[model samples]
Target: MRFIKRLIIGFVMVIILGICLYCYARLIEPNMLLKKSYSVTVPKDVKELKIVFFTDTHFGKYYPQEKITRLVDFINEQKPDVVIFGGDLIDSYNRDQELVNIEELSKSLKKIKASYGKIAVYGNHDYGGGAEPIYEKVMTDGGFKILRDSELTLSDLNLSIIGYDDYLLGSVDPNRYQLPDAPFRIVVTHEPDVIDNIKANGSLLVLAGHSHGGQVTIPFMKGVLRPGAEKYIKGQYDLKETITGCDATMIVSEGIGMTLKPFRFLNPPNIVVVSLKHK
Candidate 1:
């Protein structure tokens, strides 16, 4: 009887500790910035291109406009040639109150400066009922051009950025957007699952968000509750034939905010800065 009581007490203590740790990680740690750096080899003649990418800013009770300001500040500091947003700019799911002040969010996002341009795509959360149009307006007002299953080329930079709509809420016709031959080709999608559907058309890099790194992951076991994440969740992936037989690298961002429940454990938010250089 004494041993059984001790075991039960130990179990309770572990649960309590887990709750405390989860609260801190979910609330405090998610707000912190994590800068991730990577280098991709491009053509020899192409000059090095710096890219700053972030995504999944739920911009609701979990993520506020203040965080957007901080993110913009950090992005400007990077002095990227191109800035790209993966998506999920808002969160208004069955809530009577507003998630974030749209005007302030727009203003803060506009503060981000890039040499080529600042681009964005829509995410699943952005299409929640009546919030889709509002989110699009915010993105446009903030100077972010939404790329919905389209391609934009920078003649001077000799680079192309391909934007795909949210896999869950929007249609994805990879054949519609052909990857123009360029020194660097980048594809941005809201969810990493799109990688499986689209054949790589000479794209060098693919960037995605929506998984939020499982939002609540444990070590070794992989993200058990990753809704948006299909086969790939977080970090980098080397694909051989996933994209039209051409090899490509796919990067999935952990994202800066939370959804459903404002709780994160083990996984933290991140900002990715990818530098394209000569081999």
Candidate 2:
């Protein structure tokens, strides 16, 4: 009888400890930022451009306005030449919780300074729960140009940026936009799965954010898989090789917010800074 009682007590303690750890990871750890830098060749002859990219600010239940303000401040401090937002600006999934203050969020985001310009794309969460228009409005109001299945060229610098829509929600067709002859060409999308379908004639770099790094990763165990992000979870990958006569690379950000159960373990939020140079 005494041994059985001890076993039950131990089980109860374990459960309690698990609960505490989960809470810390979901709430406290979500606010922590993991900043990383990378250097890539973009085929341009101009000076190196510093690009700061981040995404998935699910601004509702767990994430709030203050977090975004702080994030904007941090990005500004980086003095990025071009700022890219990967998408999912609003957490409109939870019907129980009130929506994030879109106006305030837009105001906060507008403070971010990028010398070249600020570009944005949409994620699956932005389209989920019928919040697409609201999210778009917020981004536009904040001075972010929404790029959807389109291409923008910086004529002066000989750089071209193509924006592919979300894989599930918007158009994922890479065939629509032809790769320009610019020395530097980039593709920005919300889903990293599109990297598989990209057919490029020149050196191309694609940036995306949707997986949130599985949002909850455990050692030796797989993280939660979302629909479109089942393949690329986090970090960078080489989609094509020069050995194959083509060069392309893709970067999938872990993102800054959470969804569904609101928990993250081992996978913290990320702010990626990439420097582009001539090959």
Candidate 3:
């Protein structure tokens, strides 16, 4: 009887510890590198456009410069015509005092060349990083164009990338980009759940983060629970044809780094680089 009791207690302790570890990895000290290959068909005139998007980097207090520099280097090697960084660029707990060197990371990212130019949006972590002021400085000074509930068009690529503000805080403007009667319209956002209501309306593709793919998913099943995960979370899925009948693809990234946790299980950090190929 005594031995059985001890075994039960040990099992319970392990379970508790596992949960704690997952929480940290998912929310606290998670360091991840995620890479995926996606090819989509656009008009032959599209000329194989590639875009590298970095999301939820949460660089603050713990994560450092060398790590981000390596990521930036990899992005350059991809040679994307345009680069998009989904926000949370800085992570801080002081609520007032900023942590990490975002300027350096921004400078590194600025080195990534794209004919169309780089763009980005805000995440919940961006809110923690002093929202507008700090985030604006990091990107604009670091050579990135921060889009606060606005739209920017790339005439050369014949593509339009729409940027939406932070999803967590609510009250973001969704402005329409005057797309040049093209076959594809791309939109960039920090969170995935928001797209649930967005259907495929006038857009060919939607890119988002904030799910972190549960930061650690087990085998043979979906994530135990994804943060802010709507019906579609992690990986690529269809948003369904709207009553208006729009054809848009939704790609949700597992993203890099952890906001509240610091551990990753089956899920690793990653960057989504997809080519607009001839399908």
State each model's CA lDDT, in order: 0.80, 0.80, 0.70
Candidate 2 stretches greater than 4 Å from native: 1-13, 93-97, 177-182, 241-244
Please list the residue runs of candidate 3 whose C-alpha ends up more than 4 Å from where it truly belongs after superposition: 1-32, 45-47, 93-99, 174-182, 199-203, 220-227, 242-244
lDDT string, candidate 1, 166-190, tens digits: 8788877757545555445788999
Instruction: Write the residue-wise lDDT of candidate 2 on 82-140 in tens digits.
Output: 99999887777445135576777778879999998899988887788667768789898
| TM-score-best of 1 and 2 | 1
Per-residue error for 221 in candidate 3, Å, reads 5.9
Ranking by TM-score: 1, 2, 3
lDDT of 3: 0.70
Pairing residues by index, what is the TM-score of model 2?
0.89
Worst 10 residues of 3 by lDDT: 173-182
